[model samples]
Target: MAALLDSVRAFFAPKNDDAFLIDRENPSDVVARECLLDRAMGVGRRKKSSEALRRNRVPAEGLALVARDTSGHVIGTVRLWHIDAGITPEGNAVPALLLGPLAVDADHAGKGIGGALMRAAILEARKHGHGAILLVGDAPYYERFGFTTEKTATLVMPGPSARERFLALELRDGWLEGAAGVLTASGAKMLEAPLKKAA
Candidate 1:
C-alpha cells in the first residue's frame, strides 16, 4: 500500500523536463504566452480572448498544456479550469473540470496537436477524480472525442448560448446521471469580485 501510494504521487509529480511541454502553475510563462498569442492569431476571432485569459486564471492552479516545435518554440496550448460542479437537481454532487481556450499556432493547426492536448486534458481530469467537463464549442469537432450536449439539458450556465453550443462529457459512465448547476466555486467568487469593484 505504501509503495502504491508513493508511485501514484510520483506519477503526477512535475519534472524539470515538463517545462518544455507544459506549465500548470504559471500560465504566463514565456512559451505559454507565445502559444496563446499564436492561437489567438490562428482563430482570427479575438472577441473573447481576453475574457478567456481571465477565466483561465479564475481556477485554482490553472492547468496549462503547451506544445512546442522542433525549434523549441511554443506552438499550441490548452487549459482546464477547476469548478464546483455544483449539486444536481436530484441532490447529488457533481464535481467538474471546465475545458477551454484550446489553441494551436496558425502554422500548426492541421497537425493533430490540438487533439493531443484535448486528450491529455481529459485523461488528467479523470485521473484527478473529476466527474465531468463542460464547455461551449462546436458539436462536430468535439463529438469525435465523446463530448456531447446530453448533460446541458440538466446543467444551467450563466451565459446565453444555445443548448447545442454548451456541451458536456462524462469521465465515467453515469457520472452526470443527475448532476446540474455545474459552475466553478472559485470562478463564481472571481466573477463576483469584479462585479463588486465595478459597482
Candidate 2:
C-alpha cells in the first residue's frame, strides 16, 4: 500500500522543469483559473483590498493572462484592472492599472511562472499605452520588476491594506508624480466581452 501511495504521489507531482506557455486568458479558462487561485491563495482571498477593487469589473485589455502546462492545465494567472488614482498634479483623474492576486498552483511553485506572468502583464500593459500599475504585494518580490513605494506613499486603497505592501510601477515616466488620495476602481466596461463571445 505504501508503494502504491508513493506511485500516486509521483504521478501527481509537478516536474520542476515543466514547460509552461503563457497566453491571454479566455472565457473558457475561468473555472480552472479560479480553482488554481483557490488552491494557491485560499478561499479567504476575497476579503483583500485588491479584491474590492476588482469586484464587478474586468481586467484591462490583454492584461488578464494565464500560464498553461504542457498538458494544457491552467497553472498560473495574473490580472490588471483599470483604476483611478484619485488625482494627478494637474488635477485630472489619474488613470492606472491595479495588478493583483497573482497566483500559481502550489505544485508549480519556484518554477519562475509568477515572474514570467509579471513580465508578460507589464509588457502588455505598456504596449496598450497604460501609464502605471498598483499592486499590494511584497516590495522585495515586486521591486525587481520596478515597483516601489516612493510614488505610492501618499496613495491609499479604498479598503484596508498594509501600507508597505502597496507598491506602484510606472510604465510611463512620471505617471504617478504628485498623485495622491484614494485608489478606486475605474468602472471601465469589460474589454473581454468581445473576446468571450469569440471564444
Candidate 3:
C-alpha cells in the first residue's frame, strides 16, 4: 500500500512540481472545506456541515482518504461506508460496502487523484474481506473499476436515485450470485470484524 501511494504522490507532483502525500485516515479540515464548496459535485449538503465535520474527525471511523499538496494543503478527499444491502435475491442478508463523496478541489480536478482514491478504496475493501461494494454514479466513469448495473439489480437503497445509476462491483468472484435481502445489524457487525483488530 505504501508503494501504491508513493506512485500516486509522484503522479500528482509534476504539475507546479509540488510534493504530495496521502492521509489514510481522516482528512484535514482544509481538504474537507474545499470539497464541500464544490458545486459541480453533490458534497455541499447538510451532511457536510460543521457538525458533521466534527463527527467525522475520528480516525478509522470510516474509510476516508485525502491528498495533500507541498505545503500540506488538502487537495482532494473521498470516503466509504458499510451499510446493509437493501435487497437480497436469495432471502439471506447481503452485506456490502458503499463508496461515495468523491470530491476534488477545482484546482485539482483534472488530476488522477480521484481515480487513485477509488482504486485504493477497492483494494482496501478486498484486503479487509468485503464481498462487494456499491455506488450511485455515472456508468461510464465507474465502468473502468468493474462496477456494473447487472450485478446490482436485486439491491435497493432508501433514496430517490435513478435505478440506472445504481451499480455494484464484486471484489470476489460470484459474490452476487445469491445475495439478497435487507442489511441487518448482524451484517454490520460482521463487516466490522476485519477492522476491529485494525482499529
Candidate 4:
C-alpha cells in the first residue's frame, strides 16, 4: 500500500518546468496540440460533453493558448469556446465562455503548468470582456482559481456530467446570477481538418 500511497501523493504534487513558455496557439501548433491532448485525455476524449460544445466551433479569437518547452514542442493546451448560457430573464441569450480539455502531457504532469495555463486563460478572458467561464473539472483543484459550484448550481450541460464537477467562474460579478438551462454553442462554425493518423 505504501507504493500506491506514494503514487497518489505524486499525482497531486506540483512539478514545475521552468523552461516552458505560455503563448497564444498558432496555426502550426495544431498537430502538436491535438497530439498532446490525445495523449493527456486519451482517445475517448472526443466524446466528452465539452467536446460536444466545441465540435465544429471556433475558439474565441486570441483565447486558444499553448505551453511549449524550450524545444518548442507543445506540452500543454487550453481553449475557450463561445457559448450562450441559455436564455436570460429578458429572453436574450447570455454570452459566456466554455473552458475545456485543458491538457498537459503526462510527462509534464504534477508541474504547475496546468495552473499557469488556467491563470493565463482567465486573464485573457477578462481582458476581452468575457463575463463568465464554465468548465467541468475537479472542484477541489479548480476552487483556488475562483471556480465554484455556487454559481453553477442551476446551470446544466447539454449532456451527462457529474454535477459537482460542473463549475463556473464569474469575471463579472453576477454574470451567472439568475442564469439557468442548457449551455449552447454560440459562435461561428469552424472548419477543422482531419487529424492525420500517427505512424
Candidate 5:
C-alpha cells in the first residue's frame, strides 16, 4: 500500500508541485473566476483603469487562463487583453497586451498559484506573437516576472492611475521604447450596442 501511494505521488507531484494545474480558461470557469476575483480584489476593482480597457472587450486569443486544483475547481485566474500600449515617438501606434485582474481564491492564498498563472499567461502571450505586456500592479511582485516600471513611464492610462503601479514587460527588445500617449482598447468588442428587444 505504501509503494502504491508513492507511485501516485510520483506521477502527479512532478507535474505541479502544488495540487493545481494551469489551463486555458473555458466558458465554465467564468463564474468561478469572477467570484474569486471579487473575493480577492473586492467589488471596487471594477473602477480601476485596467478595468476600463477590459470592459466590453475580449481577452486576446488563448490569453485568458485559469488555475484549477485537482478537483477541477478554478482557484486562480489571469488574462491578457489587446491594447494600444501607447504611441511611438515616430507617430506610430505601439501594440501590446494588458495583463490584469489576476486573482487567487482567498482560501488558496500562499500556494504560489498566482505566480503560476502569470507564467502560463505570459507563455501563451509570447506563443501567440505579442510583443509586450502592460499592467497596473505592485512593482516588486511583478518585477520578478520581468515587468518593470521603466518601460511604462512615458505611457498613459485612459483613466486615473498611479504611475508607480504601471508596469510592463517587453517580450521583444525595444518593444516599449519611445512608447507614449494613452493606452487604449484595441481588441474585438463584445458588442457595438446592447441587443435590441424583439419587435
Candidate 6:
C-alpha cells in the first residue's frame, strides 16, 4: 500500500521543465498545434460537444495560447472562446468563456505544461474581465485549479455531455449564481474571404 500510494502521489503531482515557456499562440503555429492536439486527444476531438460552440468562431482575443519548448516547437495548446454560458432564470444572458481542447504533446505529458497553460489562460481571462469560464473535463484534474461543478448545476451544454463533467469557475464571485439556461456560441464568427474571380 505504501509503494502504491507514493506512485499515485507522484503521478498526480506537477512536474516542471525549465526548458518550456508559455506564449501567446501565433498564427504560424497552427499545424504544430493541430498535431499536438491530435496526438494528445485523437482525431475524434472535433466531434465533442464543445466543438459546436467553437465551430466557425474565433477564440477570444489574446486568449489563444501555446507552450513552446526550448526548440521553439509548439508542445501544448489551449484556447478560450466566447460563449453565453446559459441565461439567468430571469432571462438575462450570462457572458462567459468556454475553455476546451487543452492538450499537450504526448512526450510532454506530466511536465506541468498543462497546468502552466491553465494558469496563464485563467489569468488572461481575469485580466480581460471575463465573468466566468466553463468546460467539460475530468473534475479531479481541473479541481486542483479551482474548477468545480457546484455553480454549474443549473447550466446546460448545447449538446450531450455528462452532467458531472460539466464544470465552471467564476472569476467574479457569484457570477453564476442565478445563471441557468442552455449554453450557446457567442464568439465572433470567422471572416469569409472574397470569392475568386473567374478566369
**Leading candidate by lDDT:** 6
lDDT by residue (tens digit), candidate 2, 1-199: 2322232232232554677777778889999999988888889999998898898788887788888887888999999999998797677889999998899998988787898888878877887899999999999999999999888998999998898999999999998888899998985654454544555
Candidate 6 TM-score over all chains jointly: 0.90
After the best TM-score superposition of candidate 5, give how far the Cα of residue 187 lies from its true spot, in angstroms: 0.4
Candidate 4 global Cα RMSD = 9.1
Candidate 2 deviant stretches above 4 angstroms: 1-17, 189-199
Which candidate has the highest TM-score of all? 6
Go through the candidates in order and give each one's C-alpha lDDT: 0.61, 0.84, 0.62, 0.84, 0.84, 0.85
Give per-model TM-scores: 0.68, 0.85, 0.71, 0.86, 0.88, 0.90
The superposed Cα distance between candidate 5 and the true structure at residue 6, in angstroms, equals 24
Q: Model 5, stretches more than 4 Å misplaced?
A: 1-17, 192-199
- Which has the better lDDT: candidate 3, or candidate 6? 6
Pitting candidate 1 against candidate 3, the one with the higher TM-score is 3
In model 5, pairs of residues that clash are: none
- Return the clash pairs for model 2, or none: none
Candidate 4 matches the true fold with a TM-score of 0.86
Give me the displacement of residue 172 in model 4, in angstroms.
0.3
Question: lDDT by residue for model 1 over 1-199, one digit each (tens)?
Answer: 2322232232221444332233242434565654466557554434542234335355524345566654566766666776655676777667677777677777666666677667767766776677777777889999988899987787766544567877888888887777667354444334344344555
Q: What lDDT tens digits, residue by residue, belong to model 4 across residues 87-143?
A: 777777889999988988888776777987888888888878999999999999899
After superposition, candidate 1 runs with Cα above 4 Å error: 1-62, 90-93, 182-184, 187-199
Better of 5 and 6 by TM-score: 6
Q: Give lDDT: candidate 6, residue 134.
A: 96
